[model samples]
Target chain A: MTTYNLALIGFGGVNRALAELIRDEPQRFSSLGFELRVVAITDLAFGSLVQGDGIDLAAVLAMPRGSSFDGLPGGSSDPRNEEVIKNSPADIVVEATFTSPVDGEPAVSHVRWAIESGKHVVTTNKGPVALQGTSLSKLAAGNGVRFEYEGAVMSGTPVIRLAHKMLGGLELNAVQGILNGTSNYVLGRMEAGLRLDEAIAEAQNLGYAEADPTADIGGSDVRLKVAILANELLGATIHPSDVHTTGIQDITSDDVAQALANGLRWKLIGEARRESDGRIVASVQPIALEADHPLAGISGATNAVSFTTDLLGAVTVSGPGAGRVETAYALISDIIAVDDFVKGAVRA
Target chain B: MTTYNLALIGFGGVNRALAELIRDEPQRFSSLGFELRVVAITDLAFGSLVQGDGIDLAAVLAMPRGSSFDGLPGGSSDPRNEEVIKNSPADIVVEATFTSPVDGEPAVSHVRWAIESGKHVVTTNKGPVALQGTSLSKLAAGNGVRFEYEGAVMSGTPVIRLAHKMLGGLELNAVQGILNGTSNYVLGRMEAGLRLDEAIAEAQNLGYAEADPTADIGGSDVRLKVAILANELLGATIHPSDVHTTGIQDITSDDVAQALANGLRWKLIGEARRESDGRIVASVQPIALEADHPLAGISGATNAVSFTTDLLGAVTVSGPGAGRVETAYALISDIIAVDDFVKGAVRA
Candidate 1:
């Protein structure tokens, strides 16, 4: 079997989910000639751990949920002290660190290190791709490695591959869709008669929204996603601040009821269109969409992106926008893309 | 330039559209290192022509619509009554012939010859793939060539690639979608208060429906497309007869009107699901979709397919189901696939 040494940059919920999915489907990966070996794991709170060859995944699963592996077998000698960048023997790095759209430095640093060290990088952090895609792409190009982040935008949906690879020849006209699942879920709840705080509380209870939830409900997360898409689709260098932003925080229950009465639905939409002058005009705003519009029916935590192209016309992809297993699927899909690229099956 | 020596099986509407799309943008194909050389064209009504090296696409575009190339420069010296297949010199065969689902023998014969001669084959003929995908795939595999018909299903939409290639690793549970464009257009028109015949007449006038229109409104067309999708998605042989057939023909304007009044839309949906017994079950019928359903809002000639998989969860792709440019885009996408396969970039 082709064993790949994997490094976990952060042992977050998504990384743990990836471990579970791979564990559950051992036969499938074995059939594909893949033997995933978790050689190291690194996190700020948990510090870093590097086993000589690989750690026992089965034993890791038996540990208590949300518990760090500082005292487990093959655990690092010094807990809360070692730097991840200085120590790790992995060919595939899974970067699931916290993202800050204000400055995508942490994720960017890990990506740069992975590419420069001739290791493939698969990330769910939108910050790196949104802010440093061009430079990271250049770094990967220079090092003959891959930088894939299918999880960064639409969870498990094939949006990045559809835009960057499948529709390679066509010139994209516009990309518009619901990019923030938390805001969408909150708005859907509000439309269903819940207050904003009530909906956010419910989302947090379901683990779909963060404790703060400002980045998601405020549409800043969607702005960052749109920035990534715009750079990839329109070849534009757009920052999150460059986009005109709006949030669902102001969407009252009355507004939702009014939209329903008008045979419409309210959604926090992130749209980026290439204007006639070749400048990319983008925004994340709450729009009253007709019930018949594609985006209007996307309820709950689902995410959908509609792409308008010169050749293939309008193509929309929708799926789970965020979840541990779904995001892990995206990370795995990104890894598979890198594998295909390494095998010379897909062009980068 | 990677010049492909191509012979036209039929100089029909789709062939003309593809020629025009290629003529309009030479740079698009040029960037991909493909120079499509239409060396010969054959049609029963329009006769046959053979230009030894290649035909000038620009000069051919100057001819009147539907006019034959009888007196063009370096045209066929052979009589118009003779078959061009016996005299044509080309490495690839493009079969855009009229579909005859009852037999599919004509296109199958041409496809066989192309494969036997080590020539790549690209077609818009649904009959062949529905009736003989297994045989053709085997033949193409044996000959080390390609057999692609992306336009056989959803025009320009990347359904085949999504099913057969991109999501190859996942175990697909179901493939459901609005597959027929003509029926969809007619149903949309009926929902807008037109009678069935009136809507069909409008569709015919707009070049969306064929002269007979029974193949579309009768749901046979959708059955064939579903069979193609099922074969790819399930990796099991499915005949067109295996599909549980129903059509929009019995759906009156009253039904559409009532559905609209009830906040629903009538769509001729084709659904294929894997049974617990491991058998594939499929149906083509007019289903009343709720306003919140993704397929409910898909109006006109648009098509959308939702794939439920073991890994990626649910993903939907919606796009132009049928159009001259759109269908031509499907053909070009197939060409690129074949090119990649030939260049050892993709696994067959």
Candidate 2:
């Protein structure tokens, strides 16, 4: 059987969920004529693990926190993540580290190293992609590898893939979407007469928002998503900071009521459009959309993107934007796509 | 430049639109590392034209309706379609033949011949795929070729491709959608206080419904679509006639009003759900969807499909279900997909 070795650079909720899915679907990988083996894993908080062959996913899952790999040989409680990447026998690098859109640090360097070293890269880190997609894409292409980040924008919704593969031939003009789920959930609750702070609390209690949900609520997450879309769909080299952004913090019940009065719904939408002069303009703000507009109907924690193109008019794809299983599935899907690409290349 | 020869089986509105798209976008095809050359075209009404090198697309577009291929070398006004399929030096058989779901004849035979003759097939004909997709798929596989019908179910909306390629790994349990634009437009107008007859007439006036709209209004179109989805998604070998179909012709304005009064919208929904015993139960009927349902927001000629999967929850893709450019774009996309597959095989 064909085999692919993986180096997971983060062991957070999303990565752990991916391990669970892999364990549960043995037949799936085998039927696809391959087996996925995680040869190394690295996380800042939980330390690192490495094995030349493959790690026992079940053993790691059963271990106590902080000491999961203490007894295992070649495992360290604090190891440089780059060490795992530089020496691991892996064909794909699965990056799920914390994002820093300010400079796209750590993840950006990791992706460059992976691609330069002849490994395909799949990431959920939005910062690195939004900030460095153009450079990263060029790097990957030069090295004859793939740098896919489908989970970076809309979790597992296939937004970027649809734009690049399915609608690749069309000249896409604009993209409007609800990219941040926490903000949408809060706004949806606010529409039901809840105060913004109360809505935020409810969302936090429901695990839809983090304790410090600044990136999601302050519009930075949507900004990054819009930037990613601009770069991926419009072929624009835009950083997250390049987008003019507005948060949903000022959206009160009065605003929701007024929008409803005008037969509209308030949504935190991320928009990117190609200007007539071949420039991409991107922004993130709350817009009062008519009830019939595609994005207006998207409700709590659901992400949807509508692509306006010359040949196909408007095509929309919607699904869960972010969840453990959802994000993991995106990584899995990317791996599969990379596998197909590599197999095709080898055939050629 | 790499060149791919094409044989058009029907010169209908959709095929003409596809030709126009290919003609209009010279840079698109050239940049993709391939040039498409139409080697032959066969139409029941307008006759046939065959040239191993390339048929003159511009001349055919400028000619009179019935005499499009007249005065051309090796052109016949009453040529058999099979003759072109058998004799043409084509890499792809672009089939837009008239669909006969009763047995998926003619189109089924055409596809079988194309595959057996070692040529790829990209079809917009729904009959063959819905009635005999399993056997046709097997035949194509046996011949080491592709039999793609991305435009069959929802014009060029990427329904089948999304289900098969993008979401292939998920264990999808159910699929529900508004598959027919004619029926949906009529029901949408009926909900706005128009009589059923008036709605149908308005749709006809708008060119959204055929004069003899039996296939669309009678739920047969959606039946075929659901059967195709069942086969493609759930691996259920089912025929359109096996579905319990119900037409929107019987739904009066009063029924729509009642549904609206109950805070629901009337929709001609095609649903397919996999049973516990691995049986797929599919049907096409009018259902009143709750206001917040994913498919509830689709309006006018827009079509939407919601797939329920074990890993990703519900993923929905919606767009123009049937339009000249829309459907034509689907065929082009399928051609591109086939090209990628073929190139990969050559690499192997």
lDDT of each: 0.81, 0.87
User: Which regions of candidate 1 are displaced past 4 Å?
Assistant: A44-46, A65-68, A71-73, A77-86, A190-206, A257-264, A290-292, B65-67, B71-87, B189-198, B252-264, B290-292
- Give one digit per residue, the lDDT tens place, for model 1 in A109-147: 888878877888999999999989988988998888888
Shift of residue A284 alpha carbon in model 2, Å: 0.7
Q: Number of clashing residue pairs in every model?
A: 0, 4
Q: What does candidate 2's lDDT look like per residue over B222-304, in tens digits?
A: 99999999888878888888899998989989999999889799899999999999889999999998877889888888899
Model 2 per-residue lDDT tens digits across residues A281-325 = 999999999877878878889999999988878889999999988
Error of 1 at A212 (Å): 2.7
Clashing pairs in model 2, backbone N/Cα/C closer than 3 A? A347-B347, A347-B348, A348-B347, A348-B348
Clashing pairs in 1: none
Give the top-scoring candidate (lDDT). Answer: 2
DockQ of every predicted complex: 0.54, 0.53
For candidate 2, what is the lDDT? 0.87
For each model in turn, which proportion of the native inter-chain contacts is also found? 0.51, 0.59
